[model samples]
Target: MALPSFFVTAGRRWLKLALALGGAAIAQTIPAHAAQPAAPATIRLDYLHTGNATVEQYAVERVVIEPLPWPGNMARTVDDTDRGVNLVEVVDKASGKLLYSRGFSTVFNEWRTTPEAEKTNRGFEESVRFPKPEHAVTVRILKRDENNAFTLAWSTELDPDAPDVLRKQEPSALRPIPIRVSGPSPDKVDLLILGDGYTAGEMKKFEATARRMADQLFAVSPFRERAKDFNVWALAAPTPASGVSRPSTGVHHASRLGTRYDIFGSERYVLATDNRALRELAQNAPYEFIEILVNNDTYGGGGIFGQFSTAAANSDWAKYLFIHEFGHHFAGLADEYYTSPAVYQPSGTRIEPWEPNATALRDPANLKWKKFVAPGTALPTAWPKAEFEAYSRDIQQQRVALRKQQRPESEMSALFKRELAHEEELFSRAPERRTVGAFEGANYEAKGYYRPQMQCLMFDRSEQFCTVCQDAISTIIDLYSRPAQR
Candidate 1:
């Protein structure tokens, strides 16, 4: 059977680069013996699949890279400039033939560079797709830099005759268990919200916040125009009771926390929750997207294609968080700013990003969005620092006021139950409303980053969706629902 075209191109490139490098080294090291025949390099490949099909799909979506450490002291230090490994081939372990290969730059600690500092080890990670059952695989790495003449990094072998694991991991095939919210299958989009840190008694509080978020989502594009076409599954898993006794107050001190709370920070937590939620949504309703409702007010959220989740730090800003995060989930929109810490390193100066929207296109002729941009829209939208500073101060004051006002517990419960119309009204009339120019506090940088609209729900504490955001949401919905053209 023929391998994929990408794999073929990658393999050829790897072979060419390896041969050239090896030839150069041999000519220098043993000039007299260079004419003698050299042995062909031996390569091996392997595949390691976690026993869950959903997890396998999630892994591919997240771009998990499994590292293959070089054996022996090939170089003086792991970070040596001249030291590197080239991925030669990805092959089926059951058969010795190559399935895929690529000639790509291998950085020592690429993951820790910028965006990835907080997430992974500062080491090499190659981008490889997750394989299905009977597809046992191995990747071949050639260490050909000045330090190492030749070495095989790692490989895997699998028993193809064994029973398949995918069948058992499929959620629909598993026995059904009772879960929240079942019914008449409206054409409604299913929104899944994962809980972060709400205590046992706080379930209602979280639920109300989630409902408000759902309302905000519907009020915006895609969901807004199609309000009745949606249902929300708010998963309020109580934080384990006996984990570690810490302060009951909302303020969390890092010192006294234990394993349960600590696990929330793990990548595993994010992946597992996402997989389960997506599976359930897929099995149930039309399953539009998944949203995670975070409990803390620290202000962080993430989204991916076919998935949208958000957290409500405080009841007041629930609308803003919901809409802003949906931008990422709905649109493959790149974060406009580069300041905040991220999970993946900014792929350094060499290769351009594959995201449709953002790019460091220094050349105006090659800009990806040049066609859509108005002829006069500046390449870098300039923001006056003085204006931004004033805006920041006003936003800070509003945040302070929102945090200080401790609504009665009953009111808080009502807020969670979606019974409080006053709170929604308050959000609509927020003082941060500005009809013109760029408003700060979006994407990342409070200054350089400006959202496309003036007072969008993504940019401000409002329930209104800006025209640009609305269009984006609509496009995503169409993409998800549209059938492939012949």
Candidate 2:
């Protein structure tokens, strides 16, 4: 995650400019709008030293910039090619001249807007290192159009020598600690989970939910038996209110359910949503193996490996979303169906997947889980197709009825809650709680889209991942243990 050497040189030039500008005039010219009372922008900078130096003593050698959500209600679209024009400039606090200037583009994937989507949504982080005496730095951003006309969007100052205020303020109970075990330290895999909304108090309420989700994740294949090898850091912070929801006409149409919307665009972040921002955050947590966003609601979540994973914060089914998505985030598991938003364009006609479970062909020779297939077992397990269809229809009808209710105390809540509770109780009675089966209601398809278990936490509102998922989680932990000594 180190910034390239060329970027370090650019930062130096920006600093030189800032030194030449001097501080007095620039300080006085603070925008009148900025002077007026408004919500104080909460900008946090965490300097991480990939080498032996401590973050405080570490001299920033380069600055990687990540822009954050803008402050307004506006529909703006920047393609990856068009985004490269945005520039970040670092200035010497005393001089106001630029110390470094670098340009980066927005993400290539198009993100549609909904009125409920977070407004002025920009999320990026920057890493800059300084030699000589570490000094205070002011960071400014200039976003330009095709004509090169620039508009100032953000400015902030930080002392590289100082410790991170937020880290220190984090409650000890909420901080991540190494998971200990007998023998050598299990390969450590850190999960740094970001938050959208869910204020500190709300986070506390949802902490148990988060921990339970993590526990369920580790309980699945790959992870369950190796619980001591991982660390989880929940970076819970409230997002701007404007970021809660937006109008959308695309895949985000799922947001209409209120139970499926993620105001912060969690999936976008994982898919290298914005290179500049992702790089910055990665630099901050260079050792992180996965980054999940815990949004504050009963909404659905998404995941992608080497990218990001997300889940609802306080939903009754939060545990299910967390571990199910982790299957995608950690093991590169594919959606067991052909539906949902076409976020990933299928290329070529190949069917076998690198994932451990999903398969496109009935032929054992082509499936990834051939080793696990039983002898003489049918290609597709016999399932109660008709019964499942009837059950699904019933559930949908109940969901529609519940959605129409206006109050939390409505009869609809009682009915939905009762059915959900009954399902949970039934799932709990299984002898091999971790075993996988043909679980209904998963991915986006109702037919071939089956999960590994008849009633796993991944496929329903249960509380534990199936054995296969546990194995996958464990495998990921093992993969991260050994260093690639290339």
Among these predictions, the greatest TM-score belongs to 2
Q: lDDT for every model?
A: 0.38, 0.41
Error of 1 at 170 (Å): 13
Cα lDDT of model 1 by residue, 129-219, tens digit: 2222235555455544333354564444433234432222233332211122222111123455655556678777766776666666666
* Model 2 CA deviation exceeding 4 Å by range: 1-186, 200-216, 219-222, 237-243, 246-283, 291-295, 335-350, 404-443, 446-455, 483-486
Q: What is the lDDT of residue 117 in candidate 1?
A: 43
Once model 2 is optimally superposed onto the true structure by TM-score, how far is the C-alpha of residue 430 displaced, in angstroms?
12
TM-score of each candidate? 0.46, 0.50
Displacement of residue 115 (Cα, Å) in model 1 is 8.7
Over 1-486, each residue of candidate 2 has an lDDT whose tens digit, in order, gives 233221222222322221223233323423334321111111234332122111112222333222221111011111111112245566778866454443332221123122222233322323322221135777655555334455664555666445542212212232322222111111245565554434545555445555566666666555655555554544443333312332221323211112224233432122223333443333232123444444444345666543466665555555666776766666555455322233433333443333444444435443444455455544445444455455556765665554445324245435656666755655466443333344333444454434555554445545555555556555555454423211
Clashes of each: 27, 67
Worst 10 residues of 2 by lDDT: 69-78
